[model samples]
Target chain A: MNDPAPKTVPLDDKDFRDQLVAIIPPLRAFARGLCGTRDMADDMVQDAMTRAWAARQSYAAGSNFRAWMFMILRNHYYTTLRKNARMVSWDPEVAERVLVAGPTQQDGLNVQDVQKALQKLPAEQREVLLLIGANGVSYEEAADIMGCAIGTIKSRLARGRVALTALIDGPAYKDEPSDKGSRSPAISPAG
Target chain B: MHPQDSITMPEETVPERGLKSVKETVIASDDPIGKALRRLHDEVVAEPIPEEFLRLLGEIERKLNGAVTPE
Candidate 1:
C-alpha cells in the first residue's frame, strides 16, 4: 500500500480545497437534516464552510477529513441552536413542502412522511439518526463528530431507530409539546 | 410435527421477542426505514450545489494566493 498522507498540510494546498469542495454535498445534506429547511440548511452550510476555511490551519491533514468537517459543522449547528433555539428547531410543514417539490414525485410522499417523522424525534435522537443512518457515518466517526463515546453513539442510534420506526409506522401518534428543559430537547413544530 | 412438539420448544417472553425484532429491523440493510433514510440523504447529495459556495471558496483562494509573504 502507498504511504499515508502526512498529518499536516499547508493551508494553501490545492488538495485541501478539493477535499473541502468534495465534502460540501454531504455536508449540505447533514445540515439539511439538522435545520429541516433547504434555505436555512444552505445558509448554515455556507457559514460552516467559511468557519472551516478560516480554521483550516488547525486541521490534521491525514485525519478523517469527513468526520473532522462534520464535527465542525455539528459544533457550529449546536452553537447556533444554543444561541437562538427557535431558529434551529425542525419544522415539519416546511420540510413537507420542500420534499413535495423534489424531483422524484412518486417517492415524494414517503420521503415527506419520513422527514416529518424525523422532525418529531428528539433533537438528540434525530441527529443521531441523520448522522448514522442517513449520512452513513460509522458509529466511531459519529461518536467523534458528536463528541460522545461510542457506547453513547450506539445507544442513541438504537433509540433513534426504534423511535423513528414507530413514528413513521404509527400515523396516530401526535406531537408532544415542546419540553425545552428536558434532556432530549423535544421541540414540537408549530401548527 | 407432532402436537407435543410445541411443549418442547424454548419459551420466549413477549418483550424479549419484540426487542429482538426491533433490533433486527434496525440492523437490517433492506429495512424500509433504512432505505428511506438513505434515499433522503442521497437525494440531497445528488443536488447541484449552489454556485455561491464555489464563488466564496474562490474568493478565499484568491485572497490567500495574493497575500504577500515577508522576505
Candidate 2:
C-alpha cells in the first residue's frame, strides 16, 4: 500500500491573489496579442484573473503558471464573444461585404497593409502568428499555452504568413506617400 | 495589451545611412521581412503598457493587501 502524498502549506486567499497580480503584465501582453484591441483583452484578462483567484484551490502549486492563466483568459474571451458577432463590423451590413473582400491587389507592401490584412485572418491563425512570429514564443510553448499540438502551431504560422503576404501585396494597402528627398531609408527584414 | 499591440510591417532592408532617403533603396532583407518587422517592433516599444492596466494591477495589489475588493 502507498501512503498519501504529504501535504503542503495551504495558500490563503491573499497569497493567491498576489500570485495572480504578479502574472498580469505578461498575461495582458498575451491577451492583447490575441484580441486585437486593448480594452477587450484587458477585460478578458481581468475576468480570467478574477475567476482564477476565486477558484484558487483548483490550481495546483508548482505548476505552469503562464499556461494555466492563459487558458482561463482565453476561455473567457471566447465565451464573451462568439466568432460571428466578433467578425462583423459595427455596421450590420458591412459584415456581409467584408467576408468576400480579399486583400486589395495594389496597396504595395506596408505596415498599414499588414495590419489590415491581419484583421481578416481567423482568430486561431492570428493567435498563432502573434505568439510565434511577433512575440517569439516557441512552438511547443504556444501549443502548450493554446492546448493544441505543435504541428497545429506550425500550420497556423505558415498559413497566417501566406495570408498576410497576400494582403501586403494587394491593392487595399496604400503605401505611405513620401517626398523625393524625405523618405526614410528602408531597414532590412533581417533586422 | 490589445491583439494588435505588436502588429508590424512585413520587414524592410536598411542602408548604412540613417537618412530617410536610404530607406527608399532597401526593401526586405535576405531575411525578407526585417524592414517592416523592425518598424513594428519599434512601435511596440513606443507603446507604454496602458494606464488602465496599471491601475487595475494596482487595484489587484491593494486587494491582496486587504485594502479592497475587485474594484
Candidate 3:
C-alpha cells in the first residue's frame, strides 16, 4: 500500500480549521471538474467539508489530510450520483454547455476549449486526470481517494490524456481535409 | 510517497507513438492545455470565499470550541 502512516498529533482546532480553509479552492475545482458546473460543484464541496468537519476525530494527523478530504468529497459525489442516477449527464456536448455557463469567459478561448475537452472524458478517467494533472495530487493519494490501485490510477491518466488530446486537436484535423477539398468529413474527420 | 506520485505526465514514460510528437507539444510549458489547467486552479484560488461557506466553517469552529449547541 502507498498509504502514509498516520502520525500522532494532538488535535489543534485552529490549525485544523486553517488547513480545511486552505484546501477549499482546489477542492471546489476538483468538484467542478467532476460535476461539470460551479453551483453543483460548490454544493458537493459544502457537503463534503461539512462531513469532514463532523468526522474530524476519524481523520489521522500528519498523513495526507487533503486526500482524506478528497475521499469525503468523492464519496458524497458518488452517493449523490447514485441517488439521482437518471440525471447523469452522458452527453459531453451538453455537459460542456452547462459547465462553461455562468463562469466569466475572461480566461480566453484556450481555457474554454480545455474545459470542454475535460468534460468530454469519462467521469472515472476525468477524476484521475484532474487529481493528478490539474490539482498536482499524487497518484497514490488519488488511488487512495479513488479506492483503487496505483496502477489503475496510472491507466486512467494515460487514457484520459489520449482522449483529451484527441478531443482538443480533432477539430484541426477535421478542418484540414475539408480545406484541402479532396476528402469528405465522414471519411477523414478524426484523422 | 509512492513512485507514481513522481509520474505527473505519463507521456514522459510511455513509449513513442503516432501522437507522441503532438502530445509533447500539447503538454509543453506554453501549451494552451497546460495553461488552461493552470488557469482553472488560479481562478478557483482567486475566487472569494463564499459567505455561506464561511458561515459553515464558523459553525464547525464553534462546535470544535466545545460551545454549547444552540437548539
Candidate 4:
C-alpha cells in the first residue's frame, strides 16, 4: 500500500496547494488582525485555507495566490461577522502576540507593539489597510474582495491612515520602534 | 465531490500579476514603523499555533477523501 503519497494530479493542482499552504503565515496575520483575537483568526484562516485547498482546481494556476485567497477569506470574514458579529480587536499589540512564530529581540524594538497598533483601526478600515498596506493587493482587488467599491476602500484606508498616524506619532502602544533601535528611523505608512 | 467542481473562482482566468506594485510597495517602503507594523501584521496573520493547525488540516484533507479513521 502507498504510504499516504499524494495521488497523481495535474501539475497545476499540486503546485497550487503547495503555494496555498505557504501563505498560511501571512493569512494568519491578516485573519488575526481582522478578527482581533488569535482564536477567531485561527478559525477564519483555517476556514479559508480549507476552502482554498478544496477549491484549488477552480483557481487558475497562474493567478496570484495571495489575492485569490484573500477573496475567499474576506468573504468569510464579512459574512460570518454579519451573521453573528464576532468582535475582534483592531488593536495591533494583541495582533503581534497572537501571530508570533519565533523570537523577536535583536534590538529593543518589540514586534508586539506593531501588532497592537494595527488593531487600533476600525474593522472595515483595518481590512483594507492590511490587504493593501501589507499584502499589496490593489485597492480594486481589495474592494472586490470586500465586495465594495474602490472609492469606499480608499475612504476607509484614509481614515485608517489618520488613526495609525496619531497612534505611532504618540505612545499609543508600548515599545515604539525608537525604543528598540536608536539608529533606526521611525516608519510612516504613506497609504 | 468532483475535483474540478470543488475549485472556486468567479471565472476561469485570474488576471496575471495585475497588481504587483501593491505588494512590493506595501511590503517595501524602508519606512521603519510601517515595516515594523507590517512585520507584526505578517506574524499574527498566521498565529503559528505550533502543530495543531497543520494536524487539523491533514485530518480535513483525509476526511474529504472519505478515508476511514482509526478508532
Candidate 5:
C-alpha cells in the first residue's frame, strides 16, 4: 500500500467527485494502451467510471485513490477480455490521424510503430509496461493494481521491455542486403 | 480497502521466465522504449475529456442528489 491508512469518508464528498473527474485523462490513457483502439478505450473508461461511482462507498479516504481506481479499471479490462475472446487489433490509419506526427519520427520509431509493437505483447506484460513505464506507478502500487506481488510486477516489466525492444528492432524494419539499393532509409531525417 | 472488492480475477497464469536475467535488464527511464511508452500515454492524457464523460458524471451527480433529497 503506497497510500496511508484508510478511513471512512462520505460518498458525496466534493473532493471525491473532483478526484474522479481529474482521473479521467489517465484512465483513458491506460485504457487506450490496454485496448488498441480509442473508441474501445473510451468505452472501457466510461464503464469503469460508472462502476466506480456505484461502488463509491467501498473507497477508503486518505488511501491511494488513483491506485484503487486503476485496480477497478484493470479488473474491468481483464473481465471484458475474457468475455470477448477476440482482441481488438491496432488500427494504423486511426493511429496516424490521432497521434502527434512530430517527435516520434525524430527517433526513427514513430508512434504507430510503437503502438503496433505494444499490441504484440502478452496482456500481463503489456499492462506492466503501461502502468510502470507510461503511467509512472511505483512497483508497490502496480502490484496492488494488478493483484500480484511486487516481484511479479518487476519480472513482467523487464520481459515486456526486452520483448518490446526486440519487436521494434526486429527484422521487420531491418534493411536487407539484397534490397539495400532500392530501399529508402528506415528513418527520415528530422526537418 | 482495495477496489478488487467487486471484481474477481479470472483463472489465468502468467508465465514467469528468465526471471534472473530479465530482472537485471530493468529498463532505464531514458531508454527508447520507455520514452515511446511515455509519449504514447502522454498523448492520450493530453487529449480533452470527451463530452460523453462529462455528461455521464453529471447524470451520476444528479442521481446522487436525487437519492439524498426526499421526494
Candidate 6:
C-alpha cells in the first residue's frame, strides 16, 4: 500500500471519536463567531469536521486536539474564502440585527450592545478576542491555530477589548466626543 | 455510551507565555465587558448542534467504515 495507516486510528478508538464529538460545541461557536451567522457557521463546522475525519492520521496523539481541530476549521474557512475570492471584514452593525434585546439589562450592560460592539471589531481582532477570551484557548494555542505570533494574538486581543469597550460603554464616543479638553486616561486609542 | 464516556477531557496546561499581556490596560475577565463577552460565549456554546450535523458525522463514519461507496 502506498499510503500507510495513521498512528491514531480515529474510528477504531472510541476515545478519539468521543473527543472529536466533544469538540463540536466549541468548533461551532468559533465558526459562528467567525462567520457572523448560524447557518454559515454550521456549514463551516460541517466542512471542517469532514476534513478533520479524513485527515485524522495527521493529528498528533496527546497534543491539543481541540487546537488541531480549530486549526483545521480556520484553514477550511480561509481556503473557502480564497476560492470564492472574498475576504471577511469587520462590520460593526451586523450583530445588531440578530440580538434579542430584553426589557431588563444586566448590571446596566446590555447583551445586544455587547453583540453589536463585538461585530464592530475586525475579523482578526474578534477572532483573537473570542479564541482567548471566549473559547478558552490559550495564546500559544490560539497563535498556532491562527498562524500568528503569540505577541500578535495578544496585541489583537488588547485592541479588540479596547474597541469593544469603547463601542459598548461609550456609544457616542466615536461620533461625538463628550469633552476633548478633558481626556479620560482609562480609555485611549494610543494602545 | 457510558455516562463517564461523555466527560470532557482535562484542559491542556497553559503555557507560561500564554498569560503575557500586550498592554497594561488589558481587560480582566471580571471586568463588565469581559463578563458580558463571557456570557455571550456561554450562550453560544450552549446552542444545540443541529440534526444535520449529527447526520453528517454518521455519514463520515460510514465512509470511514467503507459501508457506503464513494460517490
The list of candidate 4 runs beyond 4 A from truth reads A1-12, A89-114, A168-191, B1-23, B27-33, B45-49, B60-71
lDDT of 4 by residue, A63-159 (tens): 4567777777877776677677436435445444464465464543355554565666556656767777766666666755665565555556655
Alpha carbon lDDT of residue A122, candidate 3? 63
Order of quality (DockQ): 5, 4, 3, 6, 1, 2
lDDT per residue, candidate 5, A32-130, as tens digits? 888877888889899988887777776765567778777778888888898886664555676655454433655645666778778777777788788
Model 3, residue pairs in steric clash: none
Q: After superposition, how far is residue B48 of candidate 3 from its true place, in Å?
A: 0.9
The TM-score ranking, best first, is: 5, 1, 6, 3, 4, 2
Which wins on DockQ, candidate 1 or candidate 2? 1
Q: What is the TM-score of chain B alone in each candidate?
A: 0.50, 0.39, 0.50, 0.38, 0.58, 0.49
Better of 2 and 3 by lDDT: 3
Q: What lDDT does candidate 5 reach at residue B26?
A: 27
User: Candidate 2 lDDT, tens digit per residue, B1-71?
Assistant: 42222222211111111111111112234333333433333344345556775776677676667744455
- Candidate 6's residue-wise lDDT over A72-154, tens digit each? 77777766665653335444454444433332256646766676566556666677777777676667777677766655566
When only the first chain is scored, the TM-scores of the models are 0.78, 0.65, 0.73, 0.66, 0.79, 0.72
Model 1 agreement with the true structure over A80-152: per-residue lDDT tens digits: 7767878645665676555534634353237767776777776666787888778777666666666656556
Docking band of candidate 3: incorrect
RMSD in Å for model 4: 11.8
Candidate 2's residue-wise lDDT over A1-191, tens digit each?
99996554335666666677667766665565465455666677777776776666666555555566766766666555564366313333332232222333232345434444555666666666655555455566666655666555555565566555666666553322111122222222223
| Superposition TM-score, candidate 5 onto the true structure | 0.75
